[model samples]
Target: MSTDAVLVRVRALWEGLAAVPVSFSSATGVSVVVSPRALICPPGWMGVVALQGEAIVTAPSSGAAVAIRAAVARLSADGLVDPDLLGRALPLAEVLGPAALAYVDGDGFRPVSAGSLAVERLAVEDSELRQLLMVAGDQDAAESGLDEITSPAFVIRDGGKVIAAAGYRVWPSRTAHLCVLTAPDRRGQGLARVAGSAAVAHALEGGLLAQWRARASESRRVALALGFRELGAQLSVRLS
Candidate 1:
């Protein structure tokens, strides 16, 4: 559960949160292409994925910018951290490109935290899974792999329709990359947390590290409620 472990998987194109290896690194640098085989990446752009004191840098024939080159060299040379130097060399927005800081549970398993709402994992065979995906507007993951979401894809229903959903995609590291969705109409009802909690419970049962990476402040709140610790920020960025 250490941050280093999480970063290792991510550097290898595996998502600690998604619990799946990114088919390819789509989050390429703004101007360079690190890996030619990566998906959704243009022909050229430097890319960097940094976390847990490790930096994974990819570029076509190395990056053109001297600042980025030096910064990457520094990260490679220094195993420890100096927040100021890192801040100067690798600003998150600049380096990670609109990246987010997140919390990872390294010490112990966090219990589910949603209140009294009932949340059950969605079954691919059930019509509710499709309905939940439609209501939550998350057709990409939930819809494409309804059966693949079996371990802990959960949805909370209101009047027999889905209102909120949460689940984890398992990774090679046994980390559960959590996904939570709630219908716009159902906001402020605490249903996101409720559904999320159930998914975490299932992740714990399978002995997965529950990783919560938060892009929005609202997601951070839910992770905190679930007892995840705020680790330092990491970026999968495209260089400008």
Candidate 2:
């Protein structure tokens, strides 16, 4: 199928799956689906496929086709893909099937202190933060349609540079997904917890529930710290 056709099919599948309670996010038009204990993606894509138990996929409308096998490997590592379903999706070997691997499961959300971090709402004029997000991972935050809304962003700054960031992607249901990112050099400093709390508080202020798909351990930690409860796990697969 043409790339456009493939994109349409993949997005359709994502929409269908997201209708469930599982956590999911999309960046640059690519979708990342997270179950309670795992992460998954479509057949072809690339970039920070997984982060702190979360997953990211890339499906650019104009780039060369991504490796289906690599994409499956990323998803399978978290046990997000179903081998049986994957086999049916791609009848051809070149098309690749979902890969499977074992992963560790842990905490979800717990309570956190809102006063520990400096929180600020983001605006379109905040180009520096936007730039920081765009390069933090394989996904580009600036282009993620996040800036188009009045969604608030909470950030942690060290000196003049942003050390960490968190924000929400509000959906039509008055629910908002929590997205957090910390600079590689700034991790291990409790920045995630601080920024995450700010994001959660913002969601609560807006009367929206904060949600995210996390890796087993990270999920547990964030959920426990943020007062998020476990929903359930999800299994996803892509056909060739």
Candidate 3:
């Protein structure tokens, strides 16, 4: 898809998630709106998604939205979604993200080269999936989103032990939100890229847009290797 078409689809997804109409453009700036029903964050939280050259923000009230708009007025699209920068700019009790938002269309996906390792497609309920998560530990497991995947998992094993896996959950706008995790001890061996390739390929073959949100540098590198393009960022905040 062309960049313009990709932007349109991304905007539509956020509009639905925020439960509010959002306008995105090549025009540079941030636009904020109040939406208590916003799905971008839990109730009573504020959310911002920046893409292309603009940002769409959702806050708890008109007053709060206005304050966010002013605070981010002089910031660039990338800066608008940086959690640390936003924390400094606004009165916040907590900041939750600044995850890099990436996407890949069917044409852009680059599957990793075939190696000796084979990917096994397994049901989400497979005990191996849970085992992989347990070994990954709390923080890594939560960040991977593996526990929430909706599709079959593409798993990799080492000597009969599950070591890595990847999958996706269908989101609004036919988007496939990806989840990839590698056993901490099995990382740096390209296992993530291999597992992620299967998941991305499956999502694309199913005609869904593949979306990867990353905070870790290793995860970002894997996404880039799979031909995903980093187009924006998303941040969630709780105001004091």
Evaluated against the true structure, the overall lDDT of model 2 is 0.48
Order the candidates by lDDT, highest first — what do you get? 3, 1, 2
The runs of at least 3 residues in candidate 1 whose Cα sits more than 4 Å from the true structure, single-residue gaps closed, are: 1-45, 52-54, 60-67, 71-97, 101-107, 113-115, 124-126, 138-150
Estimated TM-score per prediction?
A: 0.63, 0.52, 0.95
Q: Candidate 3 has which clashing residue pairs, if any?
A: none
TM-score of 3: 0.95
The runs of at least 3 residues in candidate 3 whose Cα sits more than 4 Å from the true structure, single-residue gaps closed, are 26-28
Better of 1 and 3 by lDDT: 3
Q: Residue by residue across 147-236, what tens digits does model 2's lDDT show?
A: 544566677787777767777776444556566777767766777788877777767677664555454465356555565544333343
Between candidates 2 and 3, the TM-score winner: 3
**What do the candidate models score in CA lDDT, each in turn?**
0.54, 0.48, 0.87
Which residue ranges in model 2 land beyond 4 Å of their true spot? 1-111, 114-116, 139-150, 215-220, 234-236
